[model samples]
Target: MQLPGDPRIDAIAEALLADPGDDRDLEAWAGELRISERTITRAFRSSTGLSFAHWRQALRIHRGLAMLAEGLEVHAVSDQLGYGHPSTFIAAFRRVMGTTPGAYADQP
Candidate 1:
C-alpha cells in the first residue's frame, strides 16, 4: 500500500483502478514512468510486498467482484476486465476470493 514510495507507482495504481482492462505489462509501465523495469519492479515490491502482476490481478478481481455485485453477468465482467476467457476470470476470482463469481453473486 505504501511501499513503492514513488509517485509513479501511485499514478500507475490509480490508472489501473480507473481502467483495469489495460493489459500493459511491467515494461510498459517502466517506459511510461521513464524508469528501468528493474527499478519499477524493486520499488513495487518494496512498496506493496507483491509483484505488479499480482497487485494488478488483485485490482481486477476486486473490480470484477464489484461489477458482479452490481448485477453484471459473469461473462460480461470477464470481458470488461480483459480476461480472454471466462474461465480465466473465474480461476483468478476463485484464487483471490475463494469462491466462484456466480456463487459470490448469489450471496445475499
Candidate 2:
C-alpha cells in the first residue's frame, strides 16, 4: 500500500500494515498523534487516494487474502481482522474480491 508522505499518516499506516487488526480509529490516532482528526483524514485522502476508513478497510482485506492463502478459515481471518462478526467480514471480502472467502480460498 502507498503511504502518505506525512509522517503522522505514514506512522498510522505502518502500524496498521504491521498489524491489520490494529483497530485504532481516526479519532484515536489523531488524539495520540496530537493532530486534529480533520488533518489526518485530509492527509490520508490526499496522499493515499482514499479516505482513512477506506484505506484501513483495504488494508484489512489485503491481510485477509494472505491469511486465506495460508489456509486459515474464513471465520479465523475475520476475527483476526477485528470484524465483529464473520458475516461482516464475508460481506467485505466479497465486496473487494468478488466472492466469498471460502470460494476464494478454494481457488487454485
Candidate 3:
C-alpha cells in the first residue's frame, strides 16, 4: 500500500537503512532533502508511526545486533554506532532488547 507522507521521508528512511552507523542528525538529514527539520519529523512520525529519534534508536539497536552477531565486542559496536561509551550502548540496548549484548551473543 502506498503510504501518505512526504516522499523525502522515504528517502531519509532509505539513507538511514543504508548507513545505520552514520551519525543521525535530523537537521542534516532534512537539509539533504531540502526540507525543514519539523517537516522531516512530521513525515517520519506520520509514515512510520514513530518519532525520528525513536526510529533512529531502533535502527541503532538493529545495527548493534548485527555487529554483535558478526563477533564484534560491545565496545567496538558502541564506537561503530557512534555511542560515546560501551555502557551507554549497553543501557540503550538493554532498554530496547531487554538483554545485554553479552547475553544475546551467548544464545544459540
Give the least accurate 10-residue stretch of model 1, judged by summed lDDT: 1-10
Return the TM-score for each candidate structure: 0.89, 0.93, 0.83
* lDDT rank order: 2, 1, 3
Q: Which stretches of candidate 2 lie over 4 Å from their true place?
A: none
lDDT of 2 by residue, 1-108 (tens): 666688868999888888888888888999899998999999888888889988998999998999999989988999899899999999998998899999988888
lDDT of each: 0.85, 0.89, 0.82
Over 4 Å off in model 1, which ranges?
Answer: 1-5
Residue 79 lDDT in candidate 2: 89
- TM-score-wise, the better of 2 and 3 is 2
- Return the number of clashes found in candidate 1: 2
Which clashing pairs does model 1 show? 3-47, 4-47
* TM-score of model number 3: 0.83
Q: What pairs collide in candidate 2?
A: none
Worst 10 residues of 3 by lDDT: 1-10
Each prediction's RMSD over C-alphas, in Å, is 2.0, 1.1, 3.0
Which is the leading candidate under TM-score?
2
Error of 2 at 45 (Å): 0.5
